[model samples]
Target: MGLDTPRPRAAARHPARSSPPRRSLHGLSGPPPAHERTPLIRSCHMTHRSRRQRMHPTNTPSRRADSPIESLWPHRYSGVMISIVIADDHGIVREGLKRLLEVEPEFEVCGEAKNGREVLDAVERSRPDIVVLDITMPHLGGLETLERLRNEYGDTKVILLSVHNDPTFIQSAIGLRADGYVLKDGRAEEIVTAIREVMKGGSYFSPAVAKKIVEQARSPKSKSSDPFTLLSAREREVLRLIADGLSAKEVATELSISTKTVEAHRTSLMRKLDVRKATELVRYALRHGLIEP
Candidate 1:
């Protein structure tokens, strides 16, 4: 005899729809129960609500819904249209900033997110050169988002906007290597200046925040070494230009030096300041008043 064979398991059938073999229609059909009817009706209602999941490319951080069009508003700026990502949880704030930046020739708000969780996705999806985010966003706060950005989105620089200029927040942002900071209540001109400064690869602190930095300079906690003092005036100029957003090639072109020479200056600057990224070197330059604010 063949090895003892086991019968195959029957396929499961839905009790609601499966009819008993040769059963009368009366046994299989009925008016739906109240609970079952509720689900069917509810699902139909849900279908209406889920017709579309539109995204507003320039909607900013507080918009409850998106218009599904990217940059539905054309923007004019003084310089080249530098695409930007602005994040906050407030619609008015986002729209206001976008409108403000759009007035500058060189800036445009390409994407806006309402919270930190949306920052990365917005950055990646939008490919903005700069991400201007609120420091205290929900889901992920500004500091954490900055860290994530540095590690995960290396090329996109971050600018933190907040109402507070607390030393702790600034220090943490600097520690994480933020590219820029501005007060939410700061002047519109200051915000524009910040975008330009950061775009040129320099970090900016608003006037009040700058005062906090100056205070740090006078504090006993100051590091004993002064790196800026070590640089020659010429090297310092090159550093400023580099921080101002000119590539080594552009700086070299402007200064009439070999690209190699510009690279040497950058390398030396980094070494003298004990900083790693180009942005940090720029910050070091700005912090010392080597460059205009």
Candidate 2:
């Protein structure tokens, strides 16, 4: 055999190794398939976002977030017009309210009332969803109307439109569970916003009124402003329970007394407090710390 040229050893067989696929912003040679990609993409994105935020600190968010009230009143999705009854003692005021509300397509002026009596009648006849009430109406006031509405027409909501910004008035309306409170001097838009907010099952107060409430909460209380000094401890307890929205029978049950006794205490407290109605008593209780608003 011609000295066989030593056969060259076959190159050692080896598996081909592939390089990692490169990411392409222009999608020419696109990123690796999902399963083959590294898991750090999300982490890289988050890191970039954190650096951007640190470079530009913003006081207000770029987009306004949804308010707590936005979750309420699913009926809003149904697109039903919110019916409203405007109740003010002054004809001029009622006319202005009617004019203001008429412009909003979402609202319907179901009725107008001069006083609390007419308000009741209007509510019975029209069955409006909301009542924009004046605090100082004759015969029955806003708080009284609110109380009766709570007792009789549980579905109807009330918003107190008033000139008064006193803490006692604010506390009273809140205690009676008025859905909204707006100052007469505030912009007309405020009333509209209040209506929307209240219908959303949220309370709204004028900015000034809210500020006053905050300041009062931070300030020291004076003995002279303490309404509790006018009543005995027993009377105070009864008022407290009543202000808590307990009926006479309920109060009696809670206090371990007869309903008659509860009624007597209520009457006595009303007279001593110079209040004519249960709503007024509740407001007094709220203002004096006999009960919470």
Candidate 3:
């Protein structure tokens, strides 16, 4: 199925939602060309001065230090010296995220910037342990900043939290060596979970974001589809239907197969996909773009 894309039209920002797209230098509404996006990002940094946020210096070098924030985390993780900088174009979103981070003591919102330019200056001065960046900030979007940041400061870990769940976007970040990608719709607690996971040297992706990439990777266009490709043709058929929200009986009726056959196919599919339950299989199928909702 073709992916449903809601374009970033400034004019379409609903009554209670966001802003209209600014008059582009060219007087158009679409995003800037790919190459221009990078330079535009640098321009944002070049224009900013000082930055601010909820950050305070940490006493411990490793993450084992107990900060007030770490104790409050949903999961008890060693409060590492995880200095985080926030860069999003929306002030409301940035503040909300800061408040959410306060839920867990393991994270420190060291600096905040409303645009890409401010982010660059904050990075130079803050030297944070991690940077939580939004994909489309004014002056410089996330992708542009990410490319430059990775090229220059290889030490910093970047976690992108954006509305965009495009596999292309995730692959681009992964290609540039970004540490993680989380989605904006994720619960505040999951964001903290992602931060801690990345701090612990594990890569994290929001369930949705991860699914997109995994789905793309399993597409026929990819070569090493072995793990996911092992599904028998019937298994694949049943898997796709199940993920699309059909029950076993429903799937059986549709495919003209017995309920027992559907059950067996589901079992084989689960084992092959390395997923445990129906939900995980759904996630796997969603990742592979076999399902959409």
Candidate 4:
């Protein structure tokens, strides 16, 4: 009778139904599929490559073992070498200067010339940063060559190398805007210092030359009364050739001028120098240091 409401049929026993398996955001997976992992692998590889590049830059230069200065001051030189051209009438002198200059790691002697004409040729060919020019050379003198260089190649720096420490020579160099003047008799180091100074947008003069310049500056009478200053560059060239014993035709050939033009220059030189005969011209040239005596 307690058959009761039949005990509600003992609440029919129904097995609990299991909930559906949970799923991650990627998918129902422990490890993602190959396609899903591809982006992550690429990102990791890119990060590692960037870190390697940061550790070792491509443009870094290896240390130079040859030059202590270069190694000590790596940022000073900018890795560019200075080009130089040396011109002298003497083979021995040119060789000596070449050896002296090549000692510097930054200096490269691009070419060598035995005289003023060759100096011009070398400059045209090489376009060097500097020209070390001897004052006296056959066919064309250093001063004339410097004039041509100043007109044609304004960027090229000129340094006069000369045996003459005369104030006249110094004055002429200054007037022509020469970058430096170093006496040949001075120490070989003087030329080296001159090149360095000139490259720095400064000028250099040998101690003796400097002293002469100062002396001349102080002396009002040193205004260069020497008739040599009166002659034009062409006249000077003609005078030098005549004094060197070249005939008028030979002088014409050397100068690439007609015989009549050579004669005209000769005449002009004589008038400016107040001379009469060819012998007088030779004497004047010798006295003025135009030709080697």
Q: Pick the candidate with the highest TM-score.
A: 4
User: Which parts of model 3 have CA positions greater than 4 angstroms off?
Assistant: 1-80, 220-293
Segments in model 4 whose C-alpha atoms lie over 4 Å from true places: 1-78
Candidate 2 residues 32-67, lDDT tens each?
445433222111113334534533445423211253
- lDDT: worst 10-residue window of model 4: 37-46
**Higher-TM-score candidate among 1 and 4?**
4
Candidate 1 per-residue lDDT, tens place, 128-173, comes to 7688888765445566678778888787778889876667556666
How do the residues 166-220 of candidate 4 rate in per-residue lDDT, one tens digit apiece?
6767788887889999998888888988998998789999989888888887985
Q: Estimate each model's TM-score.
A: 0.49, 0.53, 0.50, 0.72
- Backbone collisions counted per model: 10, 0, 12, 0
The local distance difference test score of model 1 is 0.67
Clashes of 3: 12
- Look at candidate 1 and tell me the lDDT of residue 98: 88
Model number with the top lDDT:
4
lDDT for model 4, on a 0 to 1 scale? 0.78
Is 1 or 2 the stronger prediction by lDDT?
Answer: 2
